[model samples]
Target: MDTPSEPGQPTRLLFLGEENLADGFRLIGFEAHPNPSPAQVEQILRQLQHTHDKAFVLVDEALMREDIPQLKRVRREGGRILVMAVPSLQGPTALSSDVAERLAALFGTATLRSE
Candidate 1:
């Protein structure tokens, strides 16, 4: 689990997805990583989990399908990290229904749509 950020510190926003997705977030001032592999995502998440700052991670939903356990573990252990699985530029994956339900339950919102 990560330590909490100091009072008034800016929360970090990170996006992990494809090149186009990373580029889109980068244009909006967010730090983005273009990682399509689940192994790489797991490694990065492990490293980021120990940082003493608030982290909002937006990941490609498709990749999440390949490693649901890793994503679940991160959500279970990451105190200062919030992970959100979002659709890629190519659109939502076939696992959208399951992912959307879980995300909605986690965040208590029904605004997330696969389409």
Candidate 2:
């Protein structure tokens, strides 16, 4: 498990998603911003993509549906940023299903089970 950095250190992990999801990350010590609009998410991505200390960005998959182009650009241009789409509190969306399929293909086995 990764421990939180000491005070004054640049943030390493960031979460932008539903309030409930963001709160979950906050509880784990990540810097989290809840319920940002797509535009706001884009702005934050632009600002943080170049920051040397930024490592990971966890965003709600549902939110990305509104601004996929921006997300793609960030993924393509962000040399070190690991942008991950996560399911919201409401449960899995199309993106999650796609991801699961891709992972299953990659690993040659079922990666997720449907309820």
Candidate 3:
């Protein structure tokens, strides 16, 4: 479970999931933020600009369905940033078929992730 910071300490990870899931991290012992929109993601990313201290950046694929292009762009210009798209608890899955196909076409590769 993740415990809240006392005063001055670095956040463990940058989470971009549903705000409701914040408790899970709290119970386990990690800090996280829930960002459910492209604007919100951009805002958070800008806020953390030049700070590569985040252990991870987690995003909900469903929430970010419309931002896959932007996400791909960000992913390509990678640094220490690790972006993952998780599925929402009570929503459609975030497999991103279109993005996956596009990626395959661009790279001329096989299935991105075979089942």
Candidates' C-alpha lDDT = 0.73, 0.71, 0.59
Task: Kindly provide the TM-score of model 2 when superposed on the true structure, using C-alpha atoms.
Answer: 0.69
- Candidate 1: regions farther than 4 A off: 1-4, 68-70, 91-99, 102-115
**Global lDDT for candidate 1?**
0.73
**Residues 27-111 of candidate 1: C-alpha lDDT, one tens digit per residue:** 9987888875777788777766656667798887677667556667877676777887777667544335455678878975546
Q: Per the 3 Å backbone cut-off, how many clashing residue pairs does candidate 3 have?
A: 6
Sort order, TM-score high to low: 1, 2, 3
In angstroms, give how far residue 96 of model 1 lies from its true place. Answer: 3.9
**Cα lDDT of model 3 overall?**
0.59
State the weakest 10-residue window (summed lDDT) of model 1.
91-100
Q: Give the Cα error of residue 21 in candidate 2, in Å.
A: 1.1
Tens-digit lDDT track for model 3 on 22-72? Answer: 557546664566555677777666544434344456666655566545466
lDDT of 2 by residue, 19-68 (tens): 98888899998789899988888878776654445558888877766755
Question: What order do candidates take by lDDT, descending?
Answer: 1, 2, 3
Error of 1 at 60 (Å): 0.6
